[model samples]
Target: MELAISIIVGFMILGAIYAIHARDILSAVIAGGIVGYSLVICFLLLKAPDLAIVQIVVETITLIIMVAVVLDSSRVEAYGKFDRPAWVTAGTAVLILAILFWFLKEASAPLAPFGENSMRMADAYVNGAVEKTGSINLVTGVVFDFRGYDTLGEATVLVTAVLGVLTILRIKGKR
Candidate 1:
């Protein structure tokens, strides 16, 4: 299992390098897709089947969107060696990868599962406020009762972000 994870991680790193070094936008996008696929494999090997499925689906959508954007632009150009000096690109890539590898290594410490907390919290909410809130579903009850206001605030923030993005990208008069 450890060896498999190491191999997957290697593939992910190589794919990321390929994506960065790819000249064409479409090729870079394809490299990104490969990276995502490799990540899915890593997730599966780590016993996260659900996350693997979700990542695969999201990666497919992202790849399609990137392809569509590239097609729309259609101004592909290839550069010869030393566009900004190969040493600079190589140094920057190594720096970024080193930082990322450090973060990942530091963050992978063993953590407790959330199921115990969820179950306890659900029990408390159900028994304590069952009649007050008139909610039966434990999960919904906890969210809509205990964290209802927070969820509403989060939704508002999300809506604002979407609106901001749309406004920034909107064509005012014409292209």
Candidate 2:
């Protein structure tokens, strides 16, 4: 698992560099998608299935949209040489990643390992309120019953994105 995660991270870093340095818009979009996919794999390896699922779905959609935009652009440039100043892009990305990893490490370092207590509560919820909530899955019970508002907000954001994209497409066609 660790080796897999390390490989994913290496790919992500390389993809970031390619995204910044590759002059072709389509290549840059693909590189960005690579980074997004890497992050999704990393999240899954870290045992965060829910986050991984959300990340994969959202990132895939985002990448598709970006690729569509790049395809629609009139100017199609060849993939150029790595022309960006390497130091600037690499340093900034590394610094940002380091800070983000540091913060997550600190945040998770103090978390208690899951044990019987969590299981017992989950079982209790399942046995007690599963039918009442009309949710056969305990995870759904927790998400909809406990975090429904957050889900609502996420749906709102998705709706907003669709509207924005439609508006932009319309404007693009007119001009």
State which candidate has the highest TM-score.
1
Model 2 Cα shift for residue 167 (angstroms):
3.9
Measured against the true structure, the TM-scores of the candidates, in listed sequence, are: 0.58, 0.56
Per-residue CA lDDT of candidate 2, range 1-175, in tens? 7678778899999999998887777888888898998898788878778888999999989988887877877436555556789898899899999999999999977666543234446666667776678876667877788678988999999999999979986784633
For model 1, residues 1-175, the per-residue Cα lDDT tens digits are 7777788889889989998887787898898888899988888877767678889999999888889989889636677677688889999999999999998877854544432343455566667676867776555666677889988998999999999989888858764
Candidate 1: minimum summed lDDT over ten consecutive residues — where?
110-119
Task: Please give the lDDT score for candidate 2.
Answer: 0.81
After TM-score superposition, the amount by which residue 107's alpha carbon in candidate 2 deviates from its true location, in angstroms, is: 7.8
